[model samples]
Target: MRHIPNALCILRMLLVVPIAWLLTAGEYKATLWVFAFAGFTDGLDGFLAKRCGWMSELGKILDPLADKILLVSVFITLAVIGVVPVWLAATAVLRDVTITIGAITYNALYGYPHGNPTVISKINTLCQIVYLLLAVAAKAGEWAPDTALLILGAMVFVTTVVSGIDYVVTYTRKAIAASRAKHGLA
Candidate 1:
């Protein structure tokens, strides 16, 4: 029972490669189905972890790591196959890279962060996932409209930028406070 959440996360991570491969092979419908299953596992894992008290430190790290790999791989593969716009994919990747670097530096200088997701960060991730699903579905069929995709893309961009800035600002403040405390000034 305690291991269920982490196991789900590991399963999600394992799904990343097939998702990317499907995207690359232009099997948009298959990609969408696989991606949806992976996303479902993501939500289930988090729900079980928090609701059932199955949370562990490794689960903390593995869950988000799996999400990042899945999302990043899908975005990159879609961009390569010309289903998703390069700019949007680049923006998503850049934001993740920036956050990763920030976290690494913070951990080295100030010890590990609590690894909690902020509200805006969570919103940004949701937007990204929604936009990706829409894009993939559009590619899989003609159901989604261009106007909707445009609007969703714009929302994703805005949220990505805002959340990235929020993370930097929040962590910078934390780092500064930690430094001040170490110097006996806080």
Candidate 2:
């Protein structure tokens, strides 16, 4: 029971390769099913971690890593196949990359701050997932509307930029405070 959350996270990571392969092969239906299963594991892992007290340091890192891998892979593949916009995929991927770098820099300078997702960040993630699902479902002949995609795409872009900037500002402030404390200047 203690390891269940981490196990689910690991499983999600493991599913990335096959998901990517399916997307590259233009198997949108199979990709959608696999992605849905991966999404299920994501939620389940988080629930078990919080409700069952099964959280761990490793789980903290692994869960987000798995999500980033899955999302970025899918977005890039979709963009490459011309199913989704390249700019949208690039924006999503860049936001993750920027946040990751900020986290690492903060850790190196000020020790590990618990990397909790902010409300805006969570909303951003949800938008990205919803957009991806729409894109995939549309590709699979599920009748996703063009206007809907356009609206979601705009939401995703706005949220991604906003969240990325929020993270940068938050981390920069924390890092500055830590530096000042270290120098007896706070």
Candidate 3:
């Protein structure tokens, strides 16, 4: 019961391989279904964690890691298959990489860079998810228009840049403050 959220996160992570394989095989319809299922598990797990008090330290780590794996895998696959712009995929991957390096450095230098998702970060994630969903749907069923995808991609790009900057700026400030406090300069 309490571990349901963490289990769902693990399941989502495991789904990444199939999603990538489906995309590569040009089974867009199957890929869409599987991706949607993975997304649903993401939401379900978050809900269960918050509503059922099933949250744990492991859940905190696994949830975002699962999302990154799923999104990055799908984005790279879509780019390779010519379903999406390579720049979009590159931007997504780079943002994640930058954040990962920053988090690791901050954690090692100060302590765990503790925080919650900023509003912009949340919006960025939503844009990315919606864009990916539409991209898969367009490939699967021709339900999403290119114009819509273009607009969503732009939104994703903007939000991703903004959120990446926000994370760096916010955490850098925190790290500076922590350093000052440690040195009794505050």
Candidate 4:
């Protein structure tokens, strides 16, 4: 029972490869369906974890890790196939990379920098997922307009940059405070 959330997370991660393949192969409708299913699993897992008390340390790590894998993979694939702007994909990828490196450095120096996603971070994730969905849907069946995509792309770009900076600033402040506490400097 408690393992269900973690299993869903693994499922989402596994779906990433198929999603990328579908996108690359010009199977946008199929890709949209698979991608939407994958997104649904993300919400389901989170709900089960919170509502059923199925949360665990592994889930804590696995949930967001799965999201990162899916988003980064999709962004890169979209860029490769010319469905999305390359700079947007690059910005999204670089932000993740920067955060990963920051997390590693903070863990090495100040123990695991413990925290939850900020509100901005959550909005950023939502924006990215929505943007990708629209991009795929537009290709799949002309379901979205170009102007809508342009707006979403700009939202994605803003949220990505803002959340990346937010994480770095928030974590850096935490690390600094920890150092001060360790040194008894108030």
Stretches off by above 4 angstroms in model 1 are none
Candidate 2 segments whose C-alpha is farther than 4 A from its true place: none
For candidate 4, lDDT tens digit of each residue in 90-119?
A: 999999999889888988987887678889
Residue 10 alpha-carbon offset, candidate 1, angstroms: 1.2
Q: Each candidate: what lDDT?
A: 0.89, 0.90, 0.90, 0.93
Evaluated at residue 32, the lDDT of candidate 3 is 84
| lDDT (10s digit) by residue, model 3, range 52-73 | 9998988878888898888888
Clashing residue pairs in candidate 2 are none
Worst 10-residue lDDT window for candidate 3 reads 109-118
lDDT for position 158 in model 3: 94
In order, what is each prediction's RMSD in angstroms?
Answer: 1.1, 1.0, 1.0, 1.0
Q: What CA RMSD would candidate 3 show?
A: 1.0
How many clashes does each candidate structure show, in the order listed? 0, 0, 0, 0
Q: After superposition, how far is residue 148 of candidate 4 from its true place, in Å?
A: 0.9
- lDDT for position 55 in model 2: 91
RMSD of 2: 1.0
Model 4, 75: alpha-carbon shift in Å?
0.1
